[model samples]
Target chain A: MIAADLAPGAVLSLECPTITRTALALYAGASGDHNPVHIDIDACRAVGIDDVFAHGMLSMAYLGRLLTDSFPQQSVRSFEVRFTAITPVNASPTCHATVTDVEDGHAHLDLSVQLPDGTETLRGRAVVSLP
Target chain B: MPVDRSIIGSRTPAFSTVAERGRLRFFAQATGQTDPVYTDVAAAAEAGHPDLPVPPTFLFCLEMDNPARGSFLSDLGIDVRTILHGGQSFRYHAPAYAGETLTFWTEVADVQSKKGGALELIVRDTHVERDGAEIATLTGTIVVRDPRAGR
Candidate 1:
């Protein structure tokens, strides 16, 4: 949707499957982040973590997909996220965005990634240019 | 040990990568992005993009192409096991597409200690450029926890 068509408070959402160890392993290979905490259960325990968790980038990537799917790629001018909490293994996450502002040819969105329990693990915003 | 504050402002040697379509497709699929514009040239062209558009946040992955990617943490004597992904941000000046060669230059932007030096935060900013023109700026933070703090 174009910025002109977006109204403040309009929302877009996407539900992602449970984050699996295999997915994290694939992302490790794809993204070149070999951090074992994201893929190795033992490594997580060694580091004082209860278990391996999803990479923060992986959730950010989901938020990216939410934006690209709603608007054209060239229209996105900025995307940002702050990792707030650990996304545990096998947790299904949902990404949500609300049109916080639309003006000067830009649609500003407040973005978030939340676990099934409604705990927000990632939060941020994006600015998409109008076509 | 906390990361050395003196490392702030240190810059990494510039590096470049050709945005290949295959890699873009792999990233799109890996992230569960079903958008055709990210994987199909025609679909991207139909959407007004010159070519397959680089997915947002993928620039963070590209920054990893720097051969000295891990040296920053190593230089601080921090073990990889103790690090946590803290946060990340990207600002786009222009859209990047597949097959374009983009250059990246990164600098350590900030460093701070928290919880009585039990944790450290390192922030880095990377400038993404193409043909001498700016494309995007990526900023990321990594948090390192001191395992011996409580002991």
Candidate 2:
């Protein structure tokens, strides 16, 4: 695992690797967050959304997965994220995290969820404590 | 039927409890969180927290429908197995620490359905109060997926 030593402003991007509806549903089953906006396309269109979207937690969960899998001192101290927009499933979602600041054995990251067109679906930040 | 927007300001009944240290440790371990402050009370106090603070995600285990934690959506006629976790965002008025009695409530914030899918937004508000003073409010947004559609 790489150390959470990215200089402030360093950025990294990850593409959603076909985290299909089935995978999402399974996560919901395990996590108990069964929301139809993430599953019902019709429901999504009713809200003027282009397509069914992934759960906000699901997005953050992926980021959490990234933190645990890639960064050093994997345990997250305090995580804070905000959703600016919804991520559509029609195209692949690219997730990126930019190192914003580091202090007290923690690194703060500016994160984003975006589409193939580079349209941002969500933006947030997290403070992860290194081991 | 349309979801009532007036309920936004209403607060659900609060449930209170002190998290067992063992359980808190287990939760931190289960979520793969290894921060010493979460695992050690002394470390937490040294960091200025009154006690070991549970991970923010740890609340999901308590509020969300888990067999042991009880079901939050089953009464709504929602099948626990068919749903998908949609989104979660939090506005922290204060940081949550362990051993504090937390009074929590949930309200159905927004419910919108589309041709492709439906999204139910539920907000959970938890207040960590001590002697009537306000501590923190944890607002969570949950989305449950509809099962009848093709992914």
* Fnat for the candidates in order: 0.76, 0.11
In candidate 1, which residue ranges exceed 4 Å CA deviation? B147-151
Give the whole-model CA lDDT for all candidates, comma-separated. Answer: 0.87, 0.58
**Local error of candidate 1 at residue A32 (angstroms):** 1.4
Write the residue-wise lDDT of candidate 1 on B80-145 in tens digits. 878877889999999888889999999999998877878789999999999999899999988888
Top candidate, metric DockQ: 1
Q: What is each candidate's DockQ, to 2 decimals?
A: 0.72, 0.14
Error of 2 at A92 (Å): 17
| Candidate 2, B26-77: lDDT as tens digits | 6554333566777798987787777777555545545553232234455455
Model 2 chain A: worst 10 consecutive residues (lDDT sum):
A68-77
Here the TM-score of candidate 2's chain B is: 0.72
Instruction: Encode model 1's per-residue lDDT on A31-51: one tens digit a residue.
Output: 878888888888767767678
Scored by lDDT, the top model is 1
lDDT of 1 at B65: 76
